[model samples]
Target: MAQWLDAKVTKRIDWNDHLFSLRFQCADFPDYTPGQFTKVGIEQDNGVVSRPYSLVSHPQDKELEIMAVPVEDGVLSPKLHELQENDDLKVMAPATGFLVLNEVPDSDNIWLIGTGTGIGPFLSILADSEIWLRYKNVILVYAARHQNDLAYGDFIQQCQSQYASQFSYVPIVSRDKADGMLHGRIPALLQSGQIIQQAAQPLDAEQSQVMLCGNPQMIEDAMDVLKSMGLKKHLRRSPGQISQERYW
Candidate 1:
């Protein structure tokens, strides 16, 4: 079992009206693998209420970061949104998950698929230099409702600019049409072969590794599609072609 650790709010990165990034400083923090999540608890009348949040920073960082989507009616979410500098937070557990960088084998191409806040873990893993050197090409497929809903857009752009040849950001907007960005959902792109065209290469099961993170429905759909294409699900004991971290 993990112990509750006291952490303080270090900074916040506001993505939009609904989304914000919360950074916390945990003293003598436990080491965590990329794609793991923590249970953050709030002091309530009866006891403590907690929610699971994916870590957005690698273990190397002294501080840990997690993104939050404020639900006005939610008990913990609203309180999370209201956190300010020097505010205290109680993390009731250590970061834990099977979906992480260790599952990925050395490959020529890697596909990181995410929707909404599910992109957090991928962002953290990709930023690590060790993972970057293992794969020749890193293709990130990030789909959101609108451009404004896409978090960390500027940082992603900077990463692409810095590693021009090795990185690819395929932003898909479902509700709005934007210049130089893919239109429609990722499922549609896969169905119409647009993703392949945009990728400029065939997505072969043997040559690629795909990491998926998002809602249950999206995860199911992606699993079906990738399975049909000969990709296999990976686990701790048995590694395979596809790995998933269903945040929901």
Candidate 2:
């Protein structure tokens, strides 16, 4: 059985018409790793409906934060979007996920590639200072449909300022025009060697570790491109260079 605790919405930030982030205060919040997810439940006519949301805040943050793109007909998203400050929701304890840095072996560079709301976990990971200590370089490649869809710009900028020598941010806007942003999909950027050219670093199986999250199609396609470069999926028994998580 799942353990659930009552939480109160402390704050909300609406990034756009379709995307928003919510911060909830949970008295029983667990000590979760940076890339883990927690289940959020709301009572509905159907009894209770819950969904897993990756934690956007660092493990030490007093409030739990989650970024979400509201689906037109999603059972949980619509309701979640309607939530206001002080609204009550249920948060499941013992957050879990496999995207943590512990799963990745030490490497010279760490590449975080994400699309849409998939950028959530990366936010948590970057906020934690440990990643800066472990890897010599940390690069974030975020893909969104439009310029405005790029979330956490301020936070990422703060990270860049704090870890100036070691951190880099690359924003990829696929559909709309954007100044200083890569206007293409992630896989295309990888295939065309544009990302590597911009980073000025060679991403090989030996010296680079990669974590990919976002649209299932994007993940699959990006994996294909990475494989061509000799990067294989990381597994427990056969650890390799690439690790992935699918965000629905």
lDDT (C-alpha, whole model) for all candidates: 0.83, 0.91
For model 2, residues 45-95, the per-residue Cα lDDT tens digits are 766698999999998899999988778888898899999999999899989
What 10-residue stretch in candidate 2 is worst by lDDT? 194-203
- Candidate 2 RMSD to the correct structure: 1.0
Against the true structure, whose TM-score is highest? 2
Per-residue C-alpha lDDT of model 1 across residues 80-111, encoded as one tens digit per residue: 99998889888856788876877677678888
Flag clash pairs in model 1: none
The superposed Cα distance between candidate 1 and the true structure at residue 122, in angstroms, equals 0.6
Candidate 2 lDDT:
0.91
Runs of candidate 2 with Cα error greater than 4 angstroms are none
